[model samples]
Target: MKLVKVYVTLKESVLDAQGEAIKSAIQTMGYNQISDVHMGKYFELKFENDYANLEKDVDLICDDLLANPNVETYRYEILEGE
Candidate 1:
């Protein structure tokens, strides 16, 4: 078995309105040190397959389902399971 971890976040050039709103709210409560915040998504996949082909499969998954390549960037890691 293998465990796959995926992270998806907005591209650096993209504006994160939701994050900005949260940051504003936090600052309103007196957390002034928060300069910026970016929101992201994480996924954990459990698969009973060979790790050799995992990267390609994960990339496909990210491109097709997990992320929007136009506005988001994604990265993934695979770990051997016990």
Candidate 2:
């Protein structure tokens, strides 16, 4: 089997409001050293070992469904799975 670990994040040009809020809250709690934060999404997909079009399919899935092409970008790693 194969485990696909996908990470999706906003493009650099886009503002991460949620992350900024989290950082503000953390700073209010007295952690003044906080510089910046960015929020993102992670996904795990399991595929059979025999799947021949894994990479192509993964890219299509990410581009078509997992992420917004205009504001977000994604990268994934394939790992051996039990």
Candidate 3:
């Protein structure tokens, strides 16, 4: 079995209201060293031996369904042996 770790984040050109709010709140707490923040998502896709090429499968899933091409970008890593 393999575990696919997928990370999805909005494009840098897009505004991250939630992240900006968090950064602002944090700075108000007296930690002023913060530069920038971006909000993102993560998911784990588990696959058994039934898949011969899980990497390709995961890429297809990300491209076709899991991520929006215009506003979002994604990257994944596969962990095996569990």
The candidate that wins on TM-score is: 2
* lDDT tens readout by residue for model 3, 24-59: 998999989998878899989999967987888899
Candidate order (TM-score): 2, 1, 3
Name the candidate, 1 or 3, with the larger TM-score value. 1
The per-residue C-alpha lDDT of model 3 at residue 76 equals: 90
Query: Which pairs clash in the backbone of model 2?
Result: none
TM-score of each: 0.90, 0.97, 0.89
Clashes (candidate 3): 0
Candidate 3 to native Cα RMSD, angstroms? 1.4
Off by over 4 Å in 3: none
Residue 53 CA displacement from its true place in model 2, Å: 0.7
Q: Number of clashes in every candidate structure?
A: 0, 0, 0
The residue-level lDDT of candidate 3 at 25 comes to 93
Regarding lDDT, does 2 or 3 come out ahead?
2
Model 2: what TM-score? 0.97
Rank by lDDT, descending? 2, 1, 3
Report the alpha-carbon TM-score of model 1 versus the true structure: 0.90
lDDT values for all models: 0.92, 0.98, 0.90
Candidate 3 accuracy as TM-score: 0.89
